[model samples]
Target: MAFDVDHVLAEATTEELAALVCGSGSWHTTGIPRLGVPPLRLADGPHGLRVTEQLLTQAVPATCFPTAAGLGSSWNPALLKRVGEALAHEAIALGVDVVLGPGLNIKRSPLCGRNFEYFSEDPLLSGTLSAALVYGLQSNGVGGCLKHFAVNNQETDRMRVDAVVAERTLREIYLAGFQRAVTAAAPWMVMCSYNRVNGTLASQNSWLLTDVLRGDWDYSGVVVSDWGAVYDRIAALIAGLDLEMPQAQGRAEAVAAAVEAGELSREVLEVAAERLLALTDKAASAVRPAGKIGHHDLARQAALESMVLLRNDGVLPLAPQAKVALIGAFAATPRYQGSGSSKVNPRELDRLLDTLSARCDVTYAPGFRLSGELDDDLIDEALLAAEDAEVIVACLGLPDAEEAEGFDRTHMRIPENQRALVASLSEAGKPVVVVLSNGAAVEVADWVEETSALLEAWLGGEAGALALAQVLTGEAEPSGRLTETLGLRLEDYPSALMFPGESGQVMYGEGVLVGYRGFDALEREVAFPFGFGLGYTTFRYDSLTLTDTGSVVTRDLRVAVSVTLTNTGERAGAEVVQVYVRNAPASVSRPVRELRGYTKVWLEPGETRTVIVGLGIDAFAFWSTPHERFVVESGVYAIEAGPHSRDLPLSGGLRLDVPRLPSALHDESTIAEWFADTEAMEALQARAVARTGERFALSEQMYTVVAGQPLRRFAMFPGGVLTAEDVDAVLAEYGRSV
Candidate 1:
């Protein structure tokens, strides 16, 4: 029988409603079978699906694609959408309703263990890519869940740590990506984080889940708790979290008891039950096709685009017949995916050593163990292989123990023994190429200069090795850019001091300045800037022109931009034309430049293409604390177009003439605020002139003294120029305008 969500919601009793809002087991939502509501099954995803009915760790075979770090670096939203569609097809085959990911948390710190699952440090990039993925997933039958809703960055004390952040910072940085994805994709579900935001737990933070998510962003999706994230079930439900996962024991009875006692409204319970039933209906209605996917080929293609060629002294795209020495244990057993619940059991996994051997004259050696322990025999064998080979390809990365979902990394350096091997290989008089396999950015400043080439093949899944082989042999190009900056040291990061705070509270001291924004603001030197990648070919950017497409009367503030891109190098390649915006003097401090929009264009040698990117009003707006919303202060904004953040050759400016928003005045508003508002200042001067037949006047020095004081407080002074009644009338009149 086709499930009628309306009928089921009407018939469900209070007890059944309570049960319906909680999960039945680990991966299934609670369903009132008596009311004809079927359970919706969910599985862990973002990279790929982990569908398991028994142990969560042991899952059926699914094609694991490149992780978000890999996908984000690709800077191709269209590719992400295709990947999402492939995931949806696989999810249907595995009997899962929703795939719980495309984790959009900003990569605040390199030490964050779950950085693999997230897209980028920049909210615009993460949000844009995630939205594409969501659109693709839902376009097919399967549903995608946008997860760890907000500020769930680090893994250290994830379930209990308090993330203390300012409202502006939250709106601009941490929560911005989720906001973008929610508004753009409208995913079927949004999973609340485990940790507390500010002082309140995320599960019960009404401001985060209700006021901001639903009220402001208009997210009309079911809010589910991260597995075992709920502490107070009644509070979580009341705060707009509709469902509790992993079957919270006794919570359903407690909810019913609360409703019976009038402590929790029965209407809220009914609303929650209605949302669950609607979700079940939506899941059941999706018509999934029979499994017909060449996921392995897609994984290979994605992995190829995800490989970032960090640096090249012209040694890459090695001669196909060249003798290559394949060093490091990772060449044989690649760490292609991240650890923990998001891990996938690949239907087929490729090894770089095998792929290289099949293509060229390659010798293999275990330079170092994955355990990071020193072994003299392995080092000697690797050096011997390098001695006879024309080129040395050393595969190195963080071991599984170093980075996972449970804890944060202590440092950004790769294994000590691996660093030792790189040093040894450099002395062999052969061109050394370093192939990295970590999920997050690692410290390469110390040893990167020793190698002729560096390839940041971040946690490419399943067919990653085959992709690496292709890039090495010139069959494919390394087109991925750095989503996060690779700083010289871990301490260089803005969140280094406060990340995973000591006493259960982590302060977001740096505010909105994160990733390249922080680096650019401080003029800090980094190993690699964001949106930086070198392919087998080079490209030139010319003639950047921006046309104001929006009207000032309507306050649209949209700009249509076009940049001419030509492939200067011999080989065909794709370049990600990044468009960054810089606001002309504002009241608040902001990043020097923020990524507003970007587009990837493919070009052949001497082929020119005009790439168009549009900037909306949000590009020029900043979250104003006093106004309590995103406002674009009237000014000229500098628009820059380039390949990366640091290398912009084309620049233009757009003057926005939108009216400044009236100050939100109140009794507590400072005297300076009143004077700053032209209308408010004119009204005060008119009243003073009516009484004394002269304009209101105060000495510059005297105004400075009283500028910080509240406007109403001036009336309290003995023999003050203003009376209490006069002050009240001004406030009453001006407050209405605001």
Candidate 2:
């Protein structure tokens, strides 16, 4: 397979362009022939594969992959990579060039109705997993599309609401996931989100499209607008949005009109067309081979892997013969995945009732209680089921309707019926296991005390029932880590104080303090901490080594992590090693410790292997404003590595030298650090002052004065609002000030 010669086609494509665009046809329908190859099509992403009777039958058969929340629950990059490969196989088979997937939007709010389709609240977890998935797809002949490009944090007013995040926070948390995906996977396409960032719609924001995507990341892939996401086609093209999806016929003509009208440039159009051609070349020359995958089996495996056992008391891994009285309507009709685009038609689905029925005397009972409201009759039914059962399995959580793709939930409590049902079951003294299916974290404080065990099964797609069976039967040990913290309530969040601001331009008061940072900073203990998950067998960590010097670099210090397993519970299992780094003492307020690295290992009973995790400077570094670079501030770092964030094996005092000189700061550092020697700060402060002329800095947001002179008010009336006179006065003032 020869790679597309982009440089050649970029200029003329004379023979190539003649075939592609020429075949696509000209203004006069009679002038040119129609395109031989049908145009590429895209389906809904994020939740499930949204396809219909028309698109699926004709095009290449693409495999619909798991949603973001389910994938996040797994926390296994290797698994994500495999999912990408599998989806690619489906896409190639379906003749689908680009599988619209790997949505990397940050889970900004728990109330966000569409969270089931998204991954973690943390950017790194979502970014890392998404990147792996992308790599797997592109490695084959398919192009993986990383979607909802910028600050598409919510679903309500998603197409109209503006995400007014600061430049720093935008770079660090909100856009980090997309950035990581681009940097790691280099996908053929990046799908633009239908939302506004700052004041400009993402579709028309040059800062997001041109400055961030092309300039900063050097992302050479084509960027397509979400279907009907385009408003100003010319502005979108000028800002680096290459293709309008679904091939809106009038869009390109409008673009051409704009170019001829001097509103845009032929050069910009050429760049977009070149990028589009690059995608065509890549997709056309793929190594597609016929392969059959038992999607149900794979989905079941993924579901089992993704399920997190939040709480347990030696009552889990139920005996196959146990009279498990299953309660709740979700048992029969599972909310396998979220609604809206990205919905895929699974070959088959497994319900919890069917799974339990296959192995045990399952007394199926739908305790007819709405989630928040407990009907007396439903409570009686649930209690009756519990009366006879040795153990009870309560399939509980927000119904699909409770959390949809629009509007935030007013609160996070489980409905009254589910709560009442659980209370009745608890009183019966039956060992109970509560299964939760939700997109984001919910307040589980009330249910925590009574429930014997709790499992968070985020909307698993396809083999959801089978996956639930495996976890219950102990086929695959639960090892998924939590991607977000389960807070007491919405008010517990620091951002909850200021987010969803009045009017427009919501200020990012917390700056980069997101996810666990909010919980850690406030010293509030959440119901469940990030990375909290359980495995069937217990593992141990020892032989901790940290070398400042010698054969190993500081980053690769042979950090021996060993866990001797006796299969304490008569079952084969796997465990996820979560490594977090804390700057015990730092220049700024950092998350108690950020997730630095992690690993998932499978070990048999009585088996032991020493796992050595390599740490790097990048792990210690944060976005340093003063240094204009990723800097690892000097401090006594604590490297705690274990299963889950709270259950980490403590290792204290891994020290590193801090920056002491100005030369250490990169060329881009525009600010001064407090710890920096006075000489460095002095030089940087002087340079900063000179750069802004001590008057019109980047902070002022507009040109106010030149050099050291301050400009007079720009035609200000009683109120300082902009007017035609104000605009002229500003121009005049700047002219005189300069």
User: Could you give candidate 1's per-residue lDDT for residues 1-738 as a string of tens digits?
Assistant: 358877877787888999889888789988788877888898988888888885455888888999999999899999999999999998888778889988999999999999999999999999999999998899887888898977999999999899999999999998899999999999999999999999999999999999999999998889999998999998898899999988868988999899999999999998888887887888888777775444999999899889999989989899978899999999999999999989998899999988989998999998998888988789899999888899999999998999989989999999999999999999999999999999998999999999999999999999999999999999998889889999999989888988878899999999999999999988999999999999999898899998887665576767888999999999999899999997778878989999999998889988999999998888998999878888888788899999999999999998887776765777777788777787877877778678767765669999988889887778567665565566667778776423
Q: CA shift at 471, candidate 1, in angstroms?
A: 0.4
Query: How many pairs in model 2 have backbone atoms within 3 A of each other, for residues 3 or more apart or on separate chains, i.e. clashes?
Result: 25
Instruction: Give the per-residue lDDT digits (tens) of candidate 2, residues 659-714.
Output: 44234332222223211345543443454345444521233434223222221233
Give the TM-score (vs. native) of candidate 2. 0.83
Error of 2 at 309 (Å): 0.6
Candidate 1, RMSD to the unseen true structure: 2.0
Cα lDDT, model 1, residue 707:
88
CA error at residue 598 for candidate 1, angstroms: 0.6
Q: Quick one: how many clashes does candidate 1 have?
A: 1
What are the lDDT figures for the candidates, one per model?
0.89, 0.68
Residues forming the 10-long window of minimal summed lDDT in candidate 1: 719-728
User: Which regions in candidate 1 have their CA more than 4 angstroms from the true location?
Assistant: 55-57, 292-294, 552-555, 686-727, 736-738
Model 2 has an lDDT value of 0.68
